[model samples]
Target: MRVQDTLKARQASIRKVVETAFKKENPPEASEIISSPHLEPLQIRDYFAGKRWWDITFQGLFDDYIGDSSACLTFMAPAGVEYYLPAYLLMAVEHYYDGGIITEDLAYRLKRSIMREDLYRMSLYSVEKKKAIVEVLVFLLKEYGDEEALEAMRAVAMHWGSDYIKAGGQELG
Candidate 1:
């Protein structure tokens, strides 16, 4: 297979695992999740999109999916993207995606696997936190089982890297 095709296969395989895990575990119900004080009315409505109440509850679902499960989307550095990105970085990616806007440089950082940067500033875009975001999402995704909910989560998660989390809970600027 061509190099590009080979890469695509790997990405697809990753998403499959995430999706399966979500279907089996099924995170907390939508009502409980939407009620989170962290999200405002607008965010809740947008998340629900008038579909099902128990949808897109696990913010972590998105994180894990792209953490390494998907290629089209990621928060971690691939083989040569930036030397290397850790598994926890996936959680950080979800955090930034949920709370902040990702930047161009940060996105590039996720694409590469050699330009390893600081983890503390990942959320602020200072060091690029896609890794953590993806990690968190993966952890959460493993808790959900509803297909609709998983898809909704993916919608938000499909746009991050898998290399944004700091190791050992280090402080960030």
Candidate 2:
């Protein structure tokens, strides 16, 4: 099938999965309504997706429930809905990296957004969160980093090389 078709199919599946998971975690009351947390992050093929996803998940949670709404809406919101999408996006990036669908110059452009600007900061409130954020960043850099960025990445790799090696991944010479 075409790429768009694949994306649409994936998106539909994501919508279903997200909805189901939402219901399971927060089981809808007899009388309730739920808004869709933005899934734009999963849509972006590059850094844009990461930025969008983080923005929507955090802002949506903060906005819809924090100050204005009643306790019902606040409790009704799908709290952990944002978690799974990041992993899905990261896995997609991993596939792209393993197949070399990226480059250094592209990596530089990508980082600005991956780090998140004009949107929420790239964070998940813990080391696991930071690691997830960084995993996407590193996956992109490995695939597209230009010499300058690659040099920067190399510096990081050098620092982390031992860790990487210990993880059974190759070290960059």
Candidate 3:
């Protein structure tokens, strides 16, 4: 087989493994808790137990995706790029913690959408709305973040370089 074909086969095998793992039926406890909207703090705590295990793997993938996208999208506008990373993280959390808990299809779709120009452009709401969006993202990071991830997110959020939107500007500045 050609080297490229061999590599493709290996990737497909690995992807199947990960997909099967994610698609396993959730525990009754997790499903029950996640299905209910009004969870007490203790209930929330219980629901999130062991979730960080997923975070360990997910964070590395998240970093890799972000790095690849940044390099690939260098020619694209950066006005709302920073927000996309955090928002993607938030959506991943929502997908895992709320939406049927886990599905590899969702994971794949989320990663594929990360670098789309339109996704960031869709975030170009009003200035006040953008500020609110940032605030919500800060809250999500505080809730789900580890030290390294938080620092990376903070760097993205506070970046004021040429690529980043200026303070008080639209496009999630």
Candidate 4:
């Protein structure tokens, strides 16, 4: 396949997996949306208010507050993270080759969230959700060769075992 075709395939896979995995998740209540300490909480809440993950367009975001929407991920509840994660994944795939800061920030935040040591955050995900995340991480690693994705994959392997990593068709030694 051509590189474009391969990228398209990866994008399709990411969209299908994420949408399938998170389709039934409810959007976090506006009040539940949290921002990083330096960011205004109300602005973050207002931006996400009444928006479903699927409904949020990447272009429509990241313009007002920061250069990218990754800020939206910081300090959120696990449920909020679950609700909004698909958007970030989709955005990252869409912008993978733009050489833009958006994809970089998205990838960075994604790795941090996955490797987070907070048991409260880690405990909320189901096995299926975790597997889906591994799948997405594998896609990012394979498609973009992102170092962040590789580190996140290792973290997932450490936390969930190498079997989950293997399921994504990648082996970590």
Q: Which regions in candidate 1 have their CA more than 4 angstroms from the true location?
A: 24-30, 36-42, 49-173
lDDT of 3 at 155: 40
Q: What stretches of model 4 exceed 4 Å from their correct place?
A: 35-39, 64-68
Q: Each model's C-alpha lDDT?
A: 0.31, 0.34, 0.34, 0.70
lDDT of 3 by residue, 1-173 (tens): 69658645644443343333233232223332233344342343242333432242344434433333222212223332232233233333343344222221233332233324354342343444333333333333443342333333334344322122233132332
Q: For model 2, how does the per-residue alpha-carbon lDDT over 1-173 read when each residue is reduced to its tens digit?
A: 69658655644554443334322232223222223343332222122212333233322433442332111212222222233334233333433333222221333433332344233222323344333333444444444343434443443344333342223232445
By TM-score, the best candidate is: 4
Candidate 3 TM-score over all chains jointly: 0.25
TM for every model, in the order presented, reads 0.28, 0.28, 0.25, 0.84
Each candidate's number of clashing pairs is 57, 6, 0, 0
Q: Output the number of the lDDT-best candidate.
A: 4
lDDT of 1 by residue, 77-152 (tens): 1221121122223222233334222321233334232233242122233232333334333333343222222332
Model 2 scores a C-alpha lDDT of: 0.34
Query: lDDT of model 3 at residue 5?
Result: 81
Tell me which of candidates 1 and 4 scores higher on TM-score. 4
Clashing pairs in 4: none
